[model samples]
Every structure is written in structure tokens, then in C-alpha cells.
Target chain A: MANVRIERLHKEFRGAGGIVHALADLTLDIADGEFISLVGPSGCGKTTALRIIAGLETPTSGRILFDGRDITRLEPRDRNIAMVFQSYALYPHMTVRQNLEYGLRKRGAPRDERARKVAAIAAMLRIEPMLDRRPLQLSGGQRQRVALGRALIRDPEVFLLDEPLSNLDAKLRVHMRAELAALHQKVRTTMVYVTHDQLEAMTLSDRIVVMNHGVMQQVGRPEEIYSRPANRFVAEFIGTPSMNMIEGQVRTEAGRPLFTGPGITVVLPRDAPQALPSSGRATLGIRPEHVSLVAPDAPGAIPARVTVSELAGPERFHFVAVEGGSIIVRTPAATVLHPGETVALGFDPDRLHLFDGTGEDAPALR
Target chain B: MPPRNAARLYPLVLLLLAFVAFPLYWMASTSLKPQTEVFRVPPTFVPETWTLRHYVELFWLTDFGLLFVNSLKVCLVSTGLALVVGSLGAYALARFRVRGKEAYGRLVLLAYMFPGALLVIPLLLLFRQLGLTNSHLGLSLAYLTFAVPFVMWVMRDFFASVPVDLEEAALIDGASRLGALWDVVLPQAVPGLIATGIFAFLFAWNEYLFALILISDESLRTLPPGMMRFVSTTDTNWGLIMAASTLATLPMALAFGLIQRYLVTGLGAGGVKG
Candidate 1:
């Protein structure tokens, strides 16, 4: 196992749309035996960063170090990194056994050794019956399992997975997610997984790296990314229903600082880390589940008219129109609230996130 | 309903099939015809008297054996050259970031569009100056000027259809870049190689104009030009001509037969993306 370190990586692509700045000056350190997930939207450079580390793509400017050895100029074969592509990329011509043994044969391993390794991996993945079958003959789930097996059989220093489970059905993806977790535990090799699904990153990664448009927004534990996002993007991106955004300003009213926007005003605690800049531009973010629904007469409540109510089994999402944009508050489905009903939305002071300024001066929150 | 549609389309299909088969049937029949039955006002659909005297005389008495050997040598060498060079060229264009790739692809096909007839005179002179006239090597070189681009373009389009990820996987699996191509990319490209090889072979095998101009030595002439030797200024022997034409077509038919199964499968290669 080897710890991978990316130092000041930059990559640019030239296409018909002109130059695409796919990755900025990004740096990351992945410890040995660690599972790191790079999560972002499409074209967000998460895959680019993974490819650079795999040596499939070279960075325009940077060095990739494996266990403190500079491997930036190494070919993929020399890098000792096994990648499981999103499409599985199983050789259509080869049988399952052949696919698993291809790497071993390339390295001129003994035939007996190759077979023994393939047999062991097949038994582990429970795909022994499928050794004779072609990739096309296998089902999607089976192909994915074989793809995983192919990577595992190599026992490379690092494994790079590019959305390996994305093509499977929902249930299979979940099942394989657990399988992958178990496999990682057993092998304990360094892995860097790239996905656009934040949930996958949250569940599978020791550290989740959130990126957008070629820049890393935050790097932290899953729960930390959820509870303490680094910026507006992470706060909005890491949650399912998405965190609520209320564009407001910090105003000094009667010698006390208050967050005021539209029809809502709340006094800021003295210990708040985020403060309004001289431009008086600031935004407050709160998760949907974090916002409490209270009676209209409740203290510290902001009045809002309910626009819609959605049910997800026992949980309810109440969409309320307030401020510049609406915020959805999560509540129990048993709660009785009709559209257009006047209610109050409350915020947890400790759970709130605030950002100051815009553009380059925008504060990346803690 | 199926019977009704078949009945409606049957006559047209039969007519088209017969129209296409007639010329080939006539050529085969004429090859078997005895000299007395060669010109009996109208052509015979089948030879009343079947014989192989023309084949025997042509092979033994005429320069047929030398010509046939020369054609085989030239066609095989040129096809081999084209496939080897073309596949490498195609791989580069398909996988690498070549500057002005679109223009380069179009420029490759432009060599195909430029008429072979236009190049004959200039090529003949160049061959003469280079002491390549009257040689199979000169003729093969001329064929490559047309064949390489055709093979390259077709194989480029074919190589592009193969997923780059497969090659990358091979590369990551202890294979060098060329090793990956040899193990993964080339194995998947058999159908394309066969198709391109057949085309290049046929182009060299059946080509007449450049062969006639470049080869002046009777011993060095390929099948097409050598067969023309039967056509004297006074009279043309239709029987020998037909027999030689049939002989010349045998290699192409064998090539198609060898690759027929792969043709259907290769054309349907987008089936398993994973």
C-alpha cells in the first residue's frame, strides 16, 4: 500500500469549445489504507483529478507522489494503480477467467499461479460459475462484480474507481457499495473513488472531497462535510433536499448585530465566525431538516406562507415562500398543514452558516 | 400477410437477382465453352460441350504461370505492407491528439478520391526513372498510393469504434502502450484488418491500367495485363479471356468466404459497451 499525494495539479483541455480548464491548482493527500471519495457534478474535474493520479492523464503542471516517490512521469503500468472504469470496460472478447488473469499473464506470472489467484478472487466475488462466460453474456451486476474482481486480482498499490457502481440498478448499487466496503476492509489498499453521487461518497469514503468546476470546495469526513461545510457550494451540494439559502445582511440595530433579509430578522450571536463585509452582502444557509416548524406566535420565529407539502413516507417536506427564495423545512408527515397556511420557520442558531461578499472576495465558511 | 407481401415482392426480387447473376453466369459458362461454341450468333446460357483445354493451353503454352505468380506476389506484398503501415497510422490518428485531425482525415480520403487514371502517366515516368518499370515492385508501389489511404481511413474509423478504456485497462495491467494495442486493440480489429486486406489485395490483383503501363516485360506482367496478351490486333479469344477472368476472381471470392462470418459480427460491435 502506498500513500498518494497530489501537489498543485493543473490540467487544461483544448477542444472545439476552446480551452477547458478541467483542473485548477488542486492538492490532496491520501493516507495509506484510506478510502477517499471525490464527489462533484459532471465536468467538475473530480474524474480529471482521479485520472491524473492514475497516470492515464498527465497534469499540465504538478507532481503526483506515491509514498514520497515522484511518479508524475510514470506510465499507468508503472504506477501500480488499478482503475475500475464506470463502464466496467471488461474486454468483450475475453472470458471472465481470462479477464481476471490478463494482468497476471502480462507480467509473465506462472500459469498455475495465475489460475490459483483467479480462482481465489472468483470465489471471493462469488463469480466462480461465471468464469467461462463472456462479458456480454453476463448481467450488468455480474459484469460489475467481474470488473471489481479484475482490479482486486492485481493487488495494486492503489485502486482508482470512476463511479464503478453507477451503472447498476439502485438496489444492486447499494449492495455493491457494501461489497466494496468489505473488499476495502479486507484488502486495506489505498483507494480514490470518483462519483457525482454525494450519497455514495458519504457512505464509502474516509474523506470526501467536494469539488465544482475544477476547484476543491471542501475536504473532510462525511459527517463533517454534512454538518460543517466549507462554503456555499458544499453546504448546498452535500445534502439531499439541499440546504436553504437566504440572501441577507448583518445589520447593526440599536448596537446589536442582526441578520436581516426580506421579512426576516434575527440577531447574530457575538461568537459567530462569519460577519458581513463592508459591502453588506451576506447569505445564511440552513439545512431543511434543521429548520423547525413552530406555531405562528412562537418566539424567534420567521413568518412564512406554506406553498406546498411533500411526503416521503413518514417524513414531510414543507416548502415555504420567504425572503428572496423559498426554503423547504422538513417535518413529520403526521403534521397537518395546508397550502397557503401561515406558519413560522425557526432556525437553530448553532446549525446556521453564513457567507460574506461575492466573487473572489466571497468567504469560504468553516 | 407474410405470404401476400412475399408474393408481391417476389417477381421484382427474382428479376433483380437474375439481372445481377447473368453476367457472372455467362462468364463462367464461357470459360467452359468449346471454341466451336464461342460465337454461335447468340450466347449459350450453359456450355453444351464442357472442356478445360483453354485453361491447359493458357497455363502451359502462354506466359500465364509467370503472370499468375507475379500477381500473387505483388498483391500479397502490397496488402501486407498496407495493413501493417495502415493499422499503425490508424491507431495513432484514432488515439492521439493529432493537430487538425479533422483536416487530416479528410486529406486521407482525398487521396482515394483522386482518380487512379490521372496518376498512371506520371507514375509510369517515375517508375521508368527509378528503374522500377517492368517490375512487380513498381506496380505494387503504385497500388499502395491508393491502397494505404483506403486501408488507413477504414481502419481508423474501425479503431475509433473500439473503446479507449479497454486499451487503458491493458496498459494499467502491466502492458506497455504498444503492448496494449497488440494484445487488446489488434485482437478486436481482426474483421477490419481482413476487410482492408481484401480491398487492397483486390485493388492490386485486378488493376489493369497501371499494370499495363508500368510493366513492359512479358515475364513480369500481372494477370490483368498478361491476360490481355491473348487479345491480338486481329482477333480476341473470348474463351481464354473468360477463363482467365474467372481465375483472377477466385482469390477475392475466397477472401470474402473467409471473412463472411466476422463481417456481420464486426458491423454489430457496438453491442457490449462494458
Candidate 2:
């Protein structure tokens, strides 16, 4: 219902460590009805950003504009923003019906209207059976639904969720995650979700903002982020079994760039040799799925020995040892590969992710 | 514990219980006996004939009723005042991020360390300047000197245990800070309030030093000091004193009996308020 503009938010907390930067010069604009996610590891400032948006936290210096109105100093109650805490902070003393109706009652809705809205929300959440039960009496999943219902019944301009499904069991988390996607589709409210889980951000968000150390690493659609990460941090942090990196030096061989690491050498593809830094030292990044296992003598493939093999559902992962480093190769479960087996690794030429440096801040070579 | 091991401990428990219960048993028994049986050569464990004569005299022969009303008035007012002021102060201390709040909390508890015997003289001098001597209101305020800090210390632990997330949820749901407290925080703190309230009540009810020093008017005396009238320098009315003592202890016994359930969990829930 409302577009949010965050203009250069900076938050610092004076702690035992002395001035921990919780957030740093964060500026983002969320369009109306877009479901955006702030995804990062723990202490990465994702939750701090969400709280700042909810007005629960005051930034050291920033301005928040909602629908073109400055509301940086407005109280949380006056901002018309609702948040579902990670704990699902439902009122333990109130029944589900009362919890759902709390916001409406605070806004002074009539008795009949409040009752009607509670009934409708309870039905939508499929929690009608729990309407008379307090939060303590409800199961984990039911408490989650009640918490969601409490926020949804408010019909606020912005809905904020802070890792709302983290407390549920794995199976329940998936089920609720799907239900949340469906709910967002139906309501289409401007929602900003904060989570440390990458899958949740990838599946549920219109755009994913990956963060690290209180700074935005990259912000793009889920596929764009996965396929074209902006830096070394995002490249390694996004994918499961994480992208593999080889610390190597780049040199020009016969007018073409060649990368040589401890035990392997790779010819760089044409088109972006200029993207290589002047120092010629860079990190080569590649995903497990993108690396192919071929016959030991296959042409242009790096020979390696499998150190470990793991069978995970439909895919098998092999931790293969190359000349001086190791790489994980994910292949079809049907392809049986054993430890100590000799094989060769083939890098997908188009899928190669080359970073100009080995540091976390190193830029990706496009 | 196993039933056999527990059974072995019963005798020691019974002996301790008897040590505590015997005085109360004698007070009730002596109150029911006639004046003739009070000073018998061999003290009777039970009255041969139970009579209400002493009970009647406790009301009609003296100002026991006035003293009872005065004790109730001061205790109730002080407990109420302490709960209101202490719980708010405790909640703020537990939840807010004010600078030097830790020092402030420690300072408030330091007020309780000064015993009434140590403080009674200064309090009386200050009360005299304020023209509060010989008044029930003055005694009520005197009780708060200790009662408020006690409540604040205990209830701070209780309020801290109530999750901060609940209040944040309430604020986002459109409730003001105090509204959120009333609707969410206080309800969760009910057992703490009850436990702290009883302690404050007991402190005010049993205190003798302050009541004795602050109020000299016989008409305004509370039970602790008022009970002295029965003990004359030449001879004391043992029968009347026992009857008054039994009656004085009844209200507290009834209060504890009704709220023992909350007192157990509430007192234990704070873990270590020390």
C-alpha cells in the first residue's frame, strides 16, 4: 500500500567492543506491493534494518519516507507499520481472537467490525479452531499462524517480518514458507522481510538484498544474484556446498590470459581480459553443480582424486583433491563415484565466475 | 525422594513443625479459656471449657477495634502505594536504556539496608518538621521507606523475565508504551505483584519500632504498639492479651491460606533477586 524510501541509514551501538556498527549508510527504495527480503548471516544487520523500518530502532542518522511523507521520527504506533517478531511474540494472556483483534481495537474499531475482521482473518489463516485458545495452548505452527494473523488483521501500510519461520521445525518451516508466499500474493502489501536463510529469501522475495558486515553486498532478483554475484562474499555465501575458489596468479600466454593455481591451470575465456586487475592475482570461483566430472584422461580437464563422496537424495557430492587444493563436485546420484577414484574436472566456460582478487571485497570479473 | 527415605525424615520435620506450631496452638487455646484457668499450677494443653468471654472483652473493654482499623488502614495504603510506585520504577529499570540506571537501582536497594532502628530517629525528626507525627498517614509513608525498595528489587527481576518481544509486539499493534504495559506486561506480572504486595503488607503489619516511635497518641496507635496497653507495670491481663493476639494473627493466616499457590511460584520464579 505504500512505497518506502530509506535514505542513508547509519546505526552504531556503543558496546564492550566499542562502537559496533549495526548498520552503515544503508539506502534502499522498496516499491509498493513488492516483497523484498534483506538476507544475511547472523549479526549482518538484516534484523537491524527491518527494525529501523518499523520505527522500533532509531538510526544514528537517516531519513525514512513513506509514500513521500517524512516519518523518520514518528512513533511506531503512529507509523502504521506491523512486525511479526522471530519469536512469534503473540500475547500469551490473550486468546487467538483477541490477539488478531488487538490492532483494530487499538485503532478504535467498532465491536461488530472487529469481530467480523477477526473471523475473516482466522478463517484465512485456518486457525478458527484456535480462536478461543491462548498462545501458550497453541502448537508452534498454530502460534506462527496467529502471529501472522495478528499482523494481517491490521491492514497496515507496511508489513515487516523478522525471520518469522525460524522457530518452527524444518518441515513446518517449509509449509509455512509456501503459505506465506501464497499470502503475499493474495494481499500484495509492501513487505520487507529479514532472514538469515538464503532459500527463504530466494523463494519468497521479489528482490533479494544480500548483506554482510552491515553493508549491502548485492541487491537483485534471485536468479541474477545466484548467476552473477557482485563480489566474493556473495559468490561464496549464496549457494549451498558453497562456490569453490582457487587462489591463483593470472598471466598472459600467447596473447590469451592463463590462470595457474597450486595444482591446476585454466585458460581464461575471451571478452573480459581487461577485467583482470593489474597485479594479475585473482580468485577463480565456480559452483559445485557447474563443475563436471569427466574421464581421467579427458581433454582440457584437470585430473583429480576423489577424497570423499556423499549421497544426498538425488545428487551425489564428491570432494575431489586437485594438485594442491580441493573442490566439491555435485553430480547426479545415478553417477556412482568412490573415494580415491581418479577423475577429471571440467569447468563450464560460460558459467565461470572470476574474481579479480581473493579478498571478500574483490569484484567479480564480468 | 524415595518413600522409605522420606519416612525417615518425618520425625525431624514433625519436631520442627511442633516447635513452630506450639505457640500458635497455645495462643488460640489460652484465648478460649476463662480467666480462672489462665494461671493454673499445671498449664492445661486444652481448655476444659471453651468460652468467648475474653473475645467479647477484647472488643468492648479496650480500643482493640480502633487499633485493628488503624493497622489495616496503614498496611493497605502502604502496600498499595509501594506496588504502584515500585512496579513502575522497576519496569523502567528493567526495560529502559537510561544511563547510570544500574547505579540508581543499587542506590534504591541501599535505602533498605538502613534498619528502622537506625532510621527511626531521623524519620521522626523529619516527620515532626512536616507535621506528620501522631497521624496514620505518616506511618504509612514510613513503611514505604523499606517497602518500596523491596518491591522494586523483587519486581525488577519479574518484569525482566517477561519477554521484551511482547511489549514490542504490542507497540507495533498500536498501543502506547503504558497501554502496552497495562494490557500485556502487568497481566504477565500478576503473580509477582501478589507476592510483592503480601511482603509489603507483612512488613507494615509487623513493624514495631517505627510505629512505636512515630505515633504517641493512644487513639492513633497500630496493633504492634497498641498491644502494649494490656501489659501494665504492676500486673498484666494475660487473658485479654492472648485473645487480642489470636485475633491479630487471624487476618494474616487467612490471607496466606488464600494465596499460598501464587506465593510459591511467584517467589521462586525470580530465582535470585539478591
TM-score of 2: 0.97
As a TM-score, model 1 comes out at: 0.94
DockQ of each: 0.80, 0.91
lDDT of 2 by residue, B44-70 (tens): 989998999989998898999999999
Candidate 2 positional error at B100, Å: 1.3
Once fitted onto the true fold, the runs of candidate 1 whose alpha carbons sit more than 4 angstroms away are A358-361, A364-366, B1-13, B128-131, B264-274
TM-scores of the models, in the given order?
0.94, 0.97
lDDT of 2 at B120: 90
Stretch of 10 with least lDDT, candidate 1 chain B: B265-274
- Residue B197 Cα positional deviation in candidate 1, in Å, after optimal superposition: 1.7
Highest lDDT: give the candidate number: 2
C-alpha local distance difference test of each model: 0.87, 0.92
lDDT of 2 at B14: 100
Candidate 1: DockQ? 0.80
